[model samples]
Target: MNRARHHRRARAFPLAMLLAACAVAPPVSARVQPADAPADATKASVASEIRAGVSGKLKDFYGPRGYWPLWVEKDAIGPQADALLALIASVDVDGLAPRDYDPRGLQRLIEEADASPTPKALARADLALSKAFAALVADMRRPARGIGMRYLDPEVEPRDPDPSGLLRAAAVTPSLTDYIQTAGWMSPFYMRLRTARADYRARWGDLPGITVPEGVKLRPGGNTPEIALLRHRLGLAQGAAYDRALAARVRAFQSDHGLAADGIAGGQTISALNRGPAYYDQQLALNMERARLLPGPWVRHVVVDAASARLWYYSKGALDGTMKVVAGARESQTPMMAGMIRYATLNPYWNIPPDLVQSRVAPKILKGASLKGMHYEALADWSANPAPLAQSEVDWGSVAAGRSEVRVRQLPGGDNAMGRVKFMFPNDLGIYLHDTPSRDLFAKPARHFSNGCVRLEDAQRLGRWFFGKQPVADGSAPEQHQPLPQPVPVYLTYLTAVPTAQGVQFLPDVYGRDGD
Candidate 1:
């Protein structure tokens, strides 16, 4: 019930020794070398091969330091290597393939080092360790190509690694996993979602499919073929008949699917019931892939899940509040991107997009609609000529036909489309969070009503959260652009399956983004 409270507990930091260890690890050059082997002889040969096999920016990572061994030291596997091996092996718990990070090769090298105890054996492990470490880092921060460009593409900066710095920390960190967990390993939310995956995999891993009769519907007390199938599908007691218990299950099922919690199995509910475990597994996997794309963690941030039509505010690495939001419709789906909220505009002007001007307003003006209490100017005049133009002076036909351009802006007031406030973040797509006149839309189960911008039900509250001051209701003359004391990162994500206090809630994939 208290989602924010639960989030705080989930994101609590690990032990203090862990933090100190990460801070105290010595630089790569200062690390101790094997006693018998000269540092320049075989180390140079192994480092050269590592440069060839590692390739790319990573190959040059050790060029300045003469390609020193990262994982092995003193003719054996060191603390850093042992810690990295364990972390790579546990990647599966985060929905990542451990093999992709070369756990098998790392294990074999460790075995060889234990048997031979030679500088050559140690060198081989060092090379594999460096390559696997680089691969893990890359996979953690960068998303797959298909998922990144699925919607309005995000401007994601490639994670430029500091190989020496990371190696230094790995050497001293008490737990390498904990030290790197918040870096680029995975999003904190992904850790929470993994619990849901584990729960489903344990209970319904081998569930069979349920077939709902095409034309039949099952209500609380109905006796249809579909009802019998549902009872069996849910795995109720073999001889037990459908009754109040069955109704409770149906209501619970509806709640999980983001539908009205009425004790009825309608077409939508039946359709969901018909899906087997494979469908859920695929959904979980796809969402996990999506989570892998996030670059890194932010101490304070805002995360908007367009699939669920909700925004969660995270302050100081914990969920502080949640608000309902209206996202872009299916046709013009909201994009998945991350940006920082730099400033808030009070009583903001709604500069209508060109597409809206041509599609919605030009036709209305042609039909003799009065442009009362709004500002209008030709786009050409604003840029080149600088002259005022009356609504009647412009040719609506020319504007609609793309022969001419006009700029339509709505003055801030009660009826303005952008409500009273808007949050601005610089991005190429020009999409941002703003208040809406259609406040009632937030009450709907699915709030996909915007064109491309996000409509917040609690925009004023968000303003207070960002600036520590709320906007005034009166339509002031000078628009206020207040800078936030601390800019907060905002991530717009598309996740269909997320864990909650009760269980995992499966949201409708409004954009049909789930590739499966």
Candidate 2:
């Protein structure tokens, strides 16, 4: 595929509209209730509650909207809102918002946003809500087991959800169960079902051996067609029956696709395999919600779809340069929100976080030797790591009493892990995009591999885009701190569906998040 083709397609407003979601819904004021001020106050209260319940489950069930008119009498969904709510809430969630009103507004807004242009003028807001209700209802009821994050029953993989499919399916299928599974060949949905819940080992079999086809053995010593296919994806060597190469490829694919790439095919990979094709459409829907929350003219900025594990840049409607990224690791998952670049560090100091160094990194160090290619720092005193934790020096028995502190930096060059440079973006969280020595990870369809911080595709290119005009000598700072000559913006938003050159691209929702 011509990278430019996709680059151009992604730049296309309609295409980008598919797999991206920016949470741009305007916050409603307490006073400005909809025109239909509580026709049946009690019923309105119940309906609002149901809407909230449903939106709480399916992260981006509704697309994007300024407001929803679910309260309008026209929707058939009014009667069965509870049913839809149950189905959506069936999906797993890593965390949930405690607030009640948030989900209600969010679900309605998503439905309203994805509604047809015809939907906007309809006399029935209930019809729109009902449509959303129906679609999600069908998603959970599918006869086939889901094969992505969690496996479902056997069945037909829905055809790729195109623009029109989104409309028709929107009225029928709801949870995107069919979208992630059957949508094949240049299908973006392959990326959407990637998720690693806590229990892959116990529930499902080994992860690497998973295959839709029959006769594939997952044992490390066996080389089967399934293994070869997986190996090919990972850029590993193919050895007739038992290709050692397939292990890495399977691991990478599993990692990228949000499977537990233990070189085994467990329940998670199966669920990822069988997800609905419209997952990308869902991504588009989700991103549209996110976009409504963004400041427009998103020029000269990086977009990291945490859901898809893909990064994008829009400079005059084009990617700054092509460099795929490895996002947050499953445990240190990336968040769903927006942030922008402020400054970057070239050969910058690595300030390891306290909690991570203590709990995760230090233990690995205590293993006494590096595992595989991982690196760590050693210090006689525990004070070296510069994070503001309450204590220091881990006491094996009272690990809690130990302070979360460890100073470690992977040096620049080949083994630097972070590669030659990093791009710094500002958010309440200490997250940013940077180049990684692990370029190999990018080839996988799903890429969740980092400690919360986003690993960008191209460091130099991102630097130029963010601070290209700024000047530098000793690298204190770029002189060109002024805004871009044309003032560009980068939007790092979450999305499941995004339009592509061929059609819409559905991606995996790596973070098993529920709610829109």
Most accurate candidate by lDDT: 1
Where does the lowest 10-residue lDDT sum fall in candidate 1? 1-10
Local distance difference test, each candidate: 0.67, 0.42
lDDT of 2 at 497: 48
TM-score, each model? Answer: 0.66, 0.39
Score candidate 1 by lDDT.
Answer: 0.67
lDDT for residue 168 in candidate 2, whole number 0-100: 37
Q: For residues 91-144, could you state the per-residue lDDT of candidate 2 as single tens digits?
A: 332122213223354355434422521222221334344444434323322222
Quote the positional error of residue 376 for candidate 1 in Å.
Answer: 4.8
Compare the candidates by TM-score and give the number of the best one: 1
Model 1 lDDT per residue over 248-324, tens place: 87787676555677877788877777777678777887787776655334346777888888887865444678899
